[model samples]
Target: MEEYPISFPMEKARTIFRCSVITYLRNYHRFAITAATFVGIPFTFAILITQAILPISDLLPIVYNRLRTLFFAAGFPPTSEFFFDLSLKLSQTITSLVLLLPFTFSFHLLAKTYVVRSFRNKNGSYMSTFISLFFTQIWNSFLVLSANSLSFFLVSFTFSCMEGFGFKSPNVIIFVSASGGVLYSILLAHAYIISNLALVCSGIEGSVGGGYIAILRACVLIRGRTATALALALPISMAMTAIEALFHYRVMRAYRNSNNITVIMAVEGILIAYLYSTIFVLDTVVNCLFYRSCKGLNLAKIDGLENCSGDDSAEEDMKNLI
Candidate 1:
């Protein structure tokens, strides 16, 4: 509650990354190959398929022309038309999202379980971790989708009401839409951030709500030290964004200039898949970094916890509600 500036500095980030990499490296050979291969394969495939198909539902035609032209120039082989044809159908998106749901969710759960087991200095099977993570992810996904849907519906209704009032200027529309989008995005991000923190906290103390509180306390503790957290977060975000941009640019550039259409098509597909995997890896690192930050901090003495009133009556209340 005190007005202190919390910061997630670069130095802290670097320290966290360094320590985590060392830990990951020490255990990498033992689990890295299997983790990357077995876990990575389905995860990457699901992400790629979903990404390719999702936008097609309502956004494809707007960009289809560009895609067609880009592929033609990229030298996609004679049968490349089949790929484009596939993209036109709604089935691709539905299929991709469906296929990806299990893999992505499972992978997330597995990753968290491993991290948890590692922190406790205990061995946990990948399958067990995966199943736990899967259920948690499903809940999280549902929470997110429902929240986003509600927010969008409200925004749309608001816009309709505004327009009905004869306030239909382009400027008004843009402002309203942008404001609505930003608000929704912020709310979504907050939910994700809280859930993520909760995941880590739960991993450490075996309670999701405890994890959320821990994160809140850490954020409060870092109020004045926020520059440190920001330093850590900004560069990582920038680097990830740059990698994504480069991936798209290269693929587009290749499509623009290539002549051996078939060869180019294969390369594009591979690259697209690779890009998806890369994003996943990057996200994994980011989460690892966050966990590392908490790991290094001397937060056991967090003052906020003292005020939380973990009283027996509170537990009783929770049980009654349940």
Candidate 2:
């Protein structure tokens, strides 16, 4: 059998990420339009609605503004004090918590179509793939949210137990919280990763099971290369964070001088929405390409996929004999 990576090959992973970016660029315009139409406008409206009613609005960083200012949309209906407060908190919580999966749902078909065309060299029905991933993600969401809440609660409870046992020193509490939070973060991140892998695998394998089995299979597929994936994902994440911060600074400055409707903020919101859609699709493509590599699939036959493929027929033959 041919040797596979037992540890991450840093250089090869960079190459993989570069290729994914190229694929994204080729499909960028269409992807951006789809994102803005479905994900962008709706999310922007949600933010506006939430901010309008919530009296204490800084819950959202950077964009939060007072209701009486330019932040308020033109001609919004007036609400009673009780109703406005109730609506504000409810909308803000719901919008903040429930945004990602729904946005992903809107862009799923377009993303899968790009993959099927780009990697598989096949013309598959984008709508069908979108519909399938939609239902699959809904089921996956319950598992993910439940586990996250439970893990977080357990971590908090452990710290509470330590405090109860009289480890009441400030220094000790700080040490424990920092260390425990890091450990919890790593475990939760691992779970998140496999959950996404399961999502990609479900699309590839066309099996439902709410992505649970796919998550396990993905864990096996990703085995020694988790660090490789993270190495590639982190830099992009950092760059995106920097871009967001820069945009926020500009928006804050713009908000100071102008009381009229803010074009700068609107444009920033649209661009960020596009970037979010891009990142989600890019992550999916990366996992797909990596999974294909692990499977020893002959992807060279699939035009643009040549950049992503290797000669791994020997590994495939070995698996066949087994």
Candidate 3:
């Protein structure tokens, strides 16, 4: 029920980022080992094997056609080849998420719990923290899925409404689509920021109410700090995107081109995956620091208010005696 200061400046966000980097570097060995074992290995093997067994190329066409039909039926203009490519990428991402859900709930969650504990310099039962994180992750995942679904529905509804309103020109449809895309991106980004903070809050709180309480706290904490949260998340997201591209180019492309996986290739893939995992750990560190900053600001505000009230009361007492 505590209130947090909503006016989080970009400068504060930068400081949090710097502190997170320093923290990661200071404990590099511990974090590296934990990330490599729990996150890197499992993520690498899961991605490599899944893509090997069920290549995205095979899934691309089906996803592309389905998207095409949906859009066209909604009275939207035919999209460019870029649309096809985008659909394929989205399909691959969804497939990856689905395949990695188990690891996400287990190994990835465990890594985050450890990172949070270490960052806070706290000692406790790993099993207890892990269990709390497990349930929190479940709720966070559900919220994320719901957000995605809502965004998709809204976009489709926009198209349908435009069509019903007789805005059938190709230019008009394209413009509307662009506007909708921007709106969708904004909403989705906010949802992700909230979800990230909720996970960190849940990890830190370890309360009996689990994710639900943490999520509400995140909402309150992030009230006016949306820009700061987005800024903090952007770098990590870009790094992860670059790593994914590297994986696709170096590992998946090689496998597809030669139709054979070499030992050297496997090692390179693992290395790239490890790099991704490190970024993931850094992301958790950043979130933890952001949470602390928000909480610190809230505490400062409360103290300031209490001091003002006490001063006013003392002034009134003095006036009465006079």
Candidate 4:
């Protein structure tokens, strides 16, 4: 039997994360070059072009008004500053997603596939994996969208019920809104995590039910390890968020203020994009390690059960002979 070294222990999220960093650094040359070429440059250009061509600032007010209308109709207070900020952030995110959809479906997917294949030491064709990942991403997008919809529906329903029961005070509404927002965040976070793991499963498993099946497997594998998964994901999420903020400040804000894109600004933007791509590569590596850890743990449990069963059978046989 080939012994599977439990390099990534499920119990120690920090250890797994550290190992992932080590692995990425060990293969830094290959991962960095490939990711920079296929992922970073293209994404940088895509973002710059999109921002230049379609300024999100122009669309922010439109989205804000739409959100305001929806909230007013939902009976939410008109003076909620939190809702206003949330609406703006949501609008910016939506605009960015729409603009970057092309690169996301193409170069980003290819980058993830390459990392997965490299980790597995597989030199096979990428066609199958790419196809599988394409579908998997679509399903993940749907799942995330559905989760968001459900969260909104639940919150709206709560407000409606409160109104129906005559609890229309501003304090009561604010309290309900806060509780509903917390619940919404929790649900969306889990959904996002599961969707990310599903992408990993599709890349590794290679089309064996990589769509809905991969999602189901991710949900199962993450059963007892949810906290570890969250912990492992936190740093990467924060790094990516910080990088985004940096890009906005250094690139977008500069462009907005000057109405000109200099060579220096472009270079800085590209560097930021490269850093973001590297983080994506690291995130993929971490997810792959996490998957292996979950599998190793599951296999260990099965082996333990088998050993116990064998011991019980031997004892029963001895008793029968006696």
lDDT for each candidate structure: 0.48, 0.53, 0.68, 0.72
RMSD of each: 13.0, 10.2, 9.1, 9.1
For candidate 2, the per-residue lDDT at 102 reads 51
Task: Encode model 1's per-residue lDDT on 1-322: one tens digit a residue.
Answer: 1221223254445544444444445445433444444455456555544453455445455455654564345333224334355334324433455656666556645645554544433344545444544445555556556666566566657766775687767666557656765777566655555445445544544433242354554445344544444544555557645644554465544555773446766676565555444444434444544554445532112221221123343222212211
lDDT for model 3 comes to 0.68
lDDT of 4 at 191: 89
Q: Candidate 2: deviation at residue 71, Å?
A: 34
Ten contiguous residues minimizing lDDT sum, candidate 2: 68-77
**Best by the lDDT measure:** 4
Q: Which model is ahead, 2 or 4, in terms of TM-score?
A: 4
Cα lDDT of model 3 by residue, 1-322, tens digit? 2223334456556656765665566567777786656655676566556655556455545665776676567555566443444456566666667777777787778778887665433445778777877877788877777776676677778778876888778777667667766776787788788878887787777755366777788889888778889999998999877887788889888988998989989889878878878888889878876787777532111210121123443223222211
Ranking by TM-score: 4, 3, 2, 1
Candidate with more favorable, higher lDDT: 2 or 4: 4
Can you tell me which runs of candidate 1 are displaced by over 4 Å? 1-27, 30-32, 53-96, 123-128, 164-166, 202-282, 285-289, 292-322
TM-scores for every predicted model: 0.56, 0.65, 0.79, 0.82
Candidate 1 least-lDDT 10 residues = 299-308
Model 3, position 38, has a per-residue lDDT of: 66
TM-score top scorer: 4
